[model samples]
Target: MKLDFDGIRLQAPFYDETHREWRDSVVRPFIDKEIVPHIEKWEKDGDIPLEVYQRAGEVGLFQTGYSEAYGGVTDGVDIFHALITGEELARPGAGGVAAALTVHSIALPPVINFGSEEMKKKVAPGVIKGTHHISLAITEPSGGSDVGNLKTTAKKDGDHFIINGSKTFITGGLKANWFTTAIRTGGEGIGGISLILIPADAKGVSRSSVGPKQGWICSDTATIYFENVRVPADQIIGKENEGFKIIVNNFNNERIGMAAGAVAYSRVCFEEAASWAKVRKTFGQPLSKHQVIRHKFAEMLRKINSTQAYMDICGWHIKNGTPNAADIAMLKVQATKTMEFCAREAMQIMGGISYVRECKTERIYREVRVMAIGGGSEEIMRDLACRQMEL
Candidate 1:
């Protein structure tokens, strides 16, 4: 029997011809040619080469949902289009490729939405062209999800702000041209936070790799140090002491993209396992013939379909500009949990062979924790959802 992997995707009303074309024609071919062939080498090298980013830019991969003036293809793009991009990027099952290639998605939005024309002119074009790289520096060594309590400080000086602090677990940090950074410029807590654009080559800016990680090895995580790094005061992305709201708003898109990727990764796991089971024999016949293995496929498909539906509704709400932070938060948790379950079951079904790097399930199994913990920990997501529900 043939296993229909595409049939696993829900027939959601939100996806039209454009979405399908973008997935099937644009992103899918790109991943098949540019990414899939080199995932193992890149993973072993601990970082993806800069050429991949330039190639992605040449194909308009980085331009979706961005402004036309800055080389973004906005006329036909919507939230679902962006989500489709995320889903396609996850197809190779090397989460590091997706994370490293798309780090600009998290970093550039604040600049586009809240930055001055000068800032936009300086930052957006080169990044969209894939000639330059940028990273969002929000997760400090002292905290991850606790954005309000971050300890990075920026003291005002003549015509500049003296930034003196650090950020950890920063994706693409080592090669970034600029950092859309969160710095403390006021008193304390959330009220004191502000966003700033700091050139990575500035006088006191330095970084070291936070590598040998459990996963995302090709993404090049870093622990950045700022020792009295003096950046012009006007480099602030938005008004001082009002950055918390911007940060909160940014999480909605990030979480949505992550959710799309997570659900897609879950589907990848299901597809890999099912393909393996159909051929791998056990007691008397193929593993796919076993009642127990068939049940595993059933459970995996059930969760994958449900999560895709949830993601679609959330995407619709976001496209209509009525995004609920709570629902987006919860959807992230749901997608990651679904990924965890599918990965575990897929590994079990594949048995010892699944433990090797040759299979996508092995890499996906290693990546489940990062998906659950990176955007927001499952515990933090649940608590945030409940708090937003006013429970």
Candidate 2:
């Protein structure tokens, strides 16, 4: 707790004085005053307050990388600045709240990349201002990890496309004003997919909560059903039958984000364990004084520092638009391994206290599983890396 980010030095020329200052001045204050105190309540209640989004918008937290015309920052996108925000927000307490608040990141890219200017004007501004919420629908209850096999269909009918299928585990589904959806638009396989910007209020579209999850307790998850919901042809994003590639690219970025979150959680574990070791007595001295305990702490630090290095390099390549797929895949694997190891070490170091519900380390341990499973599983990442090598 006393140490600054002394470990993960932002020595890259990419991050300048302004980026560090923004983190210190703007983001830190919001976390201290608004988020830290109420986060526990949000986790317990199963969702954050609705006002959190508008409050974030008022302070410009949700609009950093977007266009000025759409109520976001007018300057060019700051990749490092985004990294700082992602790391800080991930550490701010509730995983669910952070995910829901930033769900717009996943929902906006395709629209900005391919939607008509009129479509951007219609949705981006309201979403940026926090007046509207948007969610991305891709994973279905039938099978999430297998995207090509999705059964959701959108049949063309003159001016409209009638969509039918269900998407489950949709973040912000219950509250979004719009949804960036993936639908089967052609014959079969990945080539048949298309993206659409569907309004939440469209007829025949219904949503309900997807019950409880093990963690990310503060973010809302839902099952979204579209039974012949009519989406206009104009709503299609980019060219038809090109959605699969878009979704794949999107997942690569999301996996990196999830990797960053995992590292942040590992840091949380280390900090919690460090504090407990200092105060807790074992035998005749503090836990930190014991050689065995010190070694465990060292192991945890090694995993965390190593994972952070790989993730930082991956972020660097991504910011530069470099094809470092191997790094991205490896980072996810390394970071998740670090998280899993650190969570276990933390629990061991804290003994009974780590097992209790009141401790954050315990919560983080439970959260790590979903991180590995979602975005893409660890086994799947290994397979992807092998294929990238053409092995």
Number of backbone collisions per candidate? 0, 0
Please list the C-alpha lDDT of all candidates, in the order they appear: 0.92, 0.82
Residues 1-391, model 2: lDDT tens digits: 3622334332455667877886788777777777888988888899888788878777787777788877888485565666677677767535676687888888887787688899999999888878788888999988877788899999999999999999988999999888899899997889999999899999999999989999889889889999999988999998899998888787767778777778877877888888899999989899989999999878888887787777777777887788476668778888888888988998998999999877888888888887788777888888889988999
**Candidate 1: where are CA atoms >4 Å away?**
1-4
Query: Which 10 consecutive positions of candidate 2 have the poorest summed lDDT?
Result: 1-10
Please report, as a residue range, the 10-residue window in candidate 1 with the lowest summed lDDT.
1-10
TM-score of each: 0.98, 0.95
Best by TM-score: 1
Return the clash pairs for model 2, or none: none
Give the CA lDDT, 0 to 100, for residue 169 in model 2: 86
What tens digits encode model 1's per-residue C-alpha lDDT throughout 201-283? Answer: 99999999985998898899999999999999999999998898898899899999999999999988999998899999999
Q: Which candidate number has the best lDDT?
A: 1
